[model samples]
Target: MDAQPSGRAMVSRGTDTFCATDGRPATHLPVFDGSLPIMTEQPMVIEDSYTGHVSPGSAPQRRTVPGATITKMSVGPMDNNVYLVVCSATGKSVLIDAANEADRVNQLIGEHAPSLDLIVTTHQHGDHWLALEDVAAATRVDTAAHPLDADALPVRPDRLLDDGDTVTVGEVTLDVIHLAGHTPGSVALALTEAGGGRTHLFTGDSLFPGGVGKTADADKFASLLTDVETKLFDRYGDDTVVYPGHGDDTTLGAERPHLGEWRERGW
Candidate 1:
């Protein structure tokens, strides 16, 4: 993956631009030898229908990494995934997505109820920010997002995040990687705990379990692929755990080999 071809990468979403959170690595998701086997039951899933209460038949999924505790919940009619990244040391947490179901999104703060530091919108997609205003108002946490998508959001961000900006939650600090394609101003976060530990990445919809997020055309797909390959796959280790906006989680190692396939398909 070290063959760097020199050229300008085309990455953007709608009229916006791209840029890319945080947590510790959970149990190592091993990269398969030949056949890829997707792991489904390690991290506990939170069963709140985003109604400020748990669903009758779902369980909460929590995973702890080096310096952070992570919780993933699927919310809204679109089944978007919202994540809570809690700093283990200070108990301060950052909420990502808040895609829908305002009540359910509020209840996910958990019983311990860490101090809510920030609400982040991965991009300006309507599904991703449907509950943005509600969640921000309820929690009173300042919002942060890339400037490109900031105007598209219902609530104006307190801080406009750019690539390379560091968002700190307690002792955890994350590097922003701008990945513009599915929507401009789309970003992913990278968290490496103290002493260069394995990184935990919260990728909104830029990169997913099997492929990059949906793109409108060949050029857009190319822009997305270029950024994911150069910024994410080329930079992060195979052990990096990726919690996407929807569906199951996967590791960079598991998804790296399939990049060629996704590119060839032009999606």
Candidate 2:
């Protein structure tokens, strides 16, 4: 998918990465250590507002959603992909980036898995948090956001999260990581789902379908890119599906092609 400019300020995460920092393009997958804890409920709004539709994204060839599953759903805009991470056995669930469409998000989860228990935010953008109230209204779940971003909330988060912490819902466990570039308070979710069959990451604006988020810190952004390529890419590979802040779903494999160009051009 090609990138489009939304109306709001395009905040750059900076050039802290070695790969795909040019903003050319790369399908990104998050590499994570299952360490951060998840508190379960969360909320955001748009300052640099973007208005568009979310795409269905690449249909997963096969899903573990029904089996040892971690079900994810996209809501808001053109379905900005809100995720429902569920443990098939225990029926415990968490919501990620409900966006401005929490109603749709909850419907999907309530229909598919009934025991949802948490909500999370990847960053402080408006689209990510707007529908959070609706989601909370539907479910009596605890909400969570990074401690750095805890103040951005319209409502106090049930939990204030930081790096390397862990939160559990039934059997599903999620780890939180703070990559503060998108908003000085943005964070990402790294979780081991389905009894740790594999690891998954819900990177907010930190990384996108084909590129990392935009920020003012070019050097730091470049290093973040490097961390993705050398560290995250090397570990996660192209197979891992990286659920991003906006746009289509991507795999590290799809993103690998754009790395060199991003690094050289230096966005």
> Which regions of candidate 2 fall more than 4 Å away from where they truly are?
1-62, 65-67, 193-196, 217-220, 226-231
Go through the candidates in order and give the C-alpha RMSD of each one to the true structure: 16.9, 17.4
Model 2 lDDT at residue 167: 67
CA shift at 114, candidate 2, in angstroms? 1.7
Taking the tens digit of each residue's C-alpha lDDT, what string does model 1 give over 1-267?
011112121212233322211121333334568687654323334543323222222554677778887777776656677888889989998888878776566666634335879998898888887877777776677999999999988899999999889999999898999998888789999888667988988889899878999988888889989999999999999999888887778899999999999998887
TM-score for each of the candidates: 0.78, 0.68
Per-residue lDDT tens digits for candidate 2, residues 1-267, read 122222211111234211223443223424447696533222221112222223443221113632235444444445466666667678777778767544445546555556777788776767677777666655667899887777766556898788777768776677776675566677777665453455667787777766777767787677567656654577664666677776656767878788887777666
> Model 2 residue 124 lDDT?
71
TM-score of 1: 0.78
Please, what's the RMSD in Å of model 1?
16.9
Error of 1 at 211 (Å): 0.8
